[model samples]
Target: MTITTREDEERLRLLESVILNTTDGVLIAENDHNQDSKIVFVNEAFIKMSGYNKEEIIGLSPIGFFAPDASSDELAKLKDAIDKCEPCNIVVKTSKKNGTKYWVNVSVAPVSDGSGGFKHWVYIQRDVNNRRRHLQALEEQNKKLKEIAWIQSHVVRAPLARIMGLVDLLSEHHDSEELSNNQIIEAIASSANELDNIIRKIVQNTENVQNQSSL
Candidate 1:
């Protein structure tokens, strides 16, 4: 029995240490109006991320870290979700103690005691600024590609079709023209040659674009 008790104590200590030292920010808050939703627990990672020591924040409202001009409606919605014991995820701009604002992906879930009473609220926060910037860049590139595809399909193709149709018309009336109309025939032949050159250039340009896209 003595050995068993010692082992159990060791296990609990290890679990607490792991939670406190984890790299991801973790916080626990109570849902009471008098407490002003004060933080009940915060891991070391949360301290580092928020630039707040445990002593400074343990009994203070976490919402104070949010920007002063932040939307109250959004805060109300978050509070309502917590009140209903529902889990929710939201992107919020939070300010550090130094007043620098940054975007965070925050997930909140209710913690309940085994007896069905509300215990605390758990929050997980991750910085998402880099991920958001990367997604924005990808959206811009996709928009440009769509524009290029439209130009190729409609703008470039229309003129090429007209040139090809003129060549076909010349071929069909080849026998009806007089041999003495050499100059007119030469002009028609030169126009056809120019059209062929333009089509080749368009094809090369399209190929270059496709290769760049593949890269």
Candidate 2:
């Protein structure tokens, strides 16, 4: 039997340390012929990210971490990529050992031996919950802004048009005195009230959206 020399042991320790200390979580899954892929190795970052000990996670299927309600379509894509021996990148929500869920960007690639045979599948996972939430909030804010713009262009225009017409009537009837001053004044007051109400509604909706975003 060949014994590992001191130099060889030192190299191994360095490699282990490099993998363990990295921020990105790494998992190595053996390509099993008799069954589903089995997780053979996981680094310390993975343990921390998943809140699971190394002993409890090794030999388990990688899919066990997937959220219960995770999209089946995404699962199908992952399977298809594996079947074709192609790399796959997907973002999925996964549960930790403590049962708390978080978003992760998982990248899977096939590792090959020197003889061109598949050896293992390497998965690199990164937490992306904060980025996802930020994007979602931006989308919602955009939608709200669009709603406000629509109200300004369409809803607010009706009352404004009414005011313009009443003023035009007042101007045209000034010399002829066909329309009474009081009648013109009443029309303008009604249109102004309607416009004020529309503005108030827009303000309320904007405040509501802002509150939601803050939370």
Candidate number with greatest TM-score? 2
TM-score of every candidate relative to the true structure: 0.69, 0.83
What TM-score, to 2 decimals, does candidate 2 have? 0.83
Please report, in order, the local distance difference test score of every candidate based on alpha carbons.
Answer: 0.72, 0.86
Per-residue error for 155 in candidate 1, Å, reads 2.0
- Lowest summed lDDT over 10 consecutive residues: which window, candidate 2? 61-70
Once fitted onto the true fold, the runs of candidate 2 whose alpha carbons sit more than 4 angstroms away are 1-15, 174-181, 200-215
The most accurate candidate by lDDT is: 2
